[model samples]
Target: MGEHRDDLPLVLLIHGFPEYWWAWRNQIQTIADAGYEVAAIDQRGIAGSDKTPNSSDALTLAQDISAIARSLGASRIVVVGHGRGGQLAWAAPALAPGMVEGVLTFSAPHARAIQRPGTHLTLRTWRHVLTTFVPPLARRGLTDPVSLEHLLAEWSAPGNDGASSQAQIYAAAMRLPEAAGISLDQLRWSYTAVQRPTGRRYFELTKNAIEVPVWSVRGQLDPLLPERAWRQDHTFTTGNFRQITVANSGHFIPEEVPEESSQIILEFLHHVAHQA
Candidate 1:
């Protein structure tokens, strides 16, 4: 809870879907060692954090991050979001502009609403819809450590190309019995809330470009967020931004290449500090 360095700023990390604060364990240590306070939180319904019934929408999730930042006595924070967390990170700064100093995301697109029709419609989103519609089954599968482990493993190794050892480690984390603590309704809420209001309310206020510095990191081999999304989002930012692609890494950039990710983050912070 203590800020790492008196002179350095704080880093607020938001973990991706199905992952807890542990996702940033290595990054936190590395960043903290460099004299920055790191506050990595378990997003809603993922861990011990608030499991609000029916609360998986991106807007609500963004609010959760804001609340966490305020609770830590930070008026503004450098937000680092991974995967789904990145999406929320994109939206949060818009809703609470004064509370965010900068935005750094890995594998997350901008806050634009996902078009329901056409090729852009992905199987992954359908899976989320199914889970949202049927809480009991989705909750059952998500809470089952074994099932969750398998899901994370599959996510890590798309088409059997990823490292088996890494996949096993991710799977093991999901399989922990503690995964069953969150209720089915809570898990379902986490997904459904985002699709509500046609996914427009949150982005409407964010339509104007964000003025904060932004960094979007991508893995060269990541299957979750293809290069196409990155290209489309490249032109959407409002302020100064940078996009870096991590070689040979996948969606799990922090887990796959902690040093490279840390280096990129460190350099960005240093640049931001000098500009300030």
Candidate 2:
């Protein structure tokens, strides 16, 4: 709605942890050009946003999206989330079905898929669990720019380390004491939520299949999230789910392939809008 006052639909973009609203910088204007109200907000505890331990929980994060949509005067919202943001995207529709129109996740899969036994928990997952249990080392690592650079290098497709280019910016943003603490909180909470015997937060999310159209996009070389786990998933309430893979891409699809990612998102939103 920056320049166009027409009743264009609303699309909320949520970035993953250790990143900020600027992470979606590539898609904001492009999506707006597609005739939709676009908002790229820094999720809680990330850069330029309020710090809160609640961002660690998926359901609560989803609630943030619903509340934002209401404020925008939209009855239903289209969501696009990446990495940890993608996890919240899935939970959003499940938590507030009547508020979400269609959902799109980038470089992330459903939390339910990852929690199942058949799912393969990669080294990256174990590393997150370890860091959560040990805080002193975590604080040091979180503060180090090299650590951030390393994550960007290791997570993306080979020969495409998106982290190196933005390491300076990210390091500066995460340097804030509150940002570091909130990140640590996410790791700790994620470990507890997954290891608990009866307090599984994702189970509550799965009780009802997401009652909206769902789309997933993954980086072909993202080691943290293997493709096998998503092969037979039918968790969408509408059962109208589709997955897209970008060639030679890693975990940070938007950063790595903005044009392709933006185009895909614009197309998906257009489809949803047409059906409405």
Q: Report lDDT per candidate.
A: 0.68, 0.75
Which residue pairs show collisions in model 1?
A: 54-189, 55-189, 56-189, 56-190, 57-193, 57-194
Please identify model 2 stretches exceeding 4 Å from their true place: 1-5, 53-55, 194-202
**Per the 3 Å backbone cut-off, how many clashing residue pairs does candidate 2 have?**
2
Worst 10 residues of 1 by lDDT: 157-166
- lDDT for model 2, please: 0.75
Tell me the deviation in Å of residue 270 in model 1.
1.6
What are the C-alpha RMSDs, in order, of all predicted structures? 4.0, 2.4
Candidate number of the best lDDT: 2
Candidate 1 clashes: the total is 6
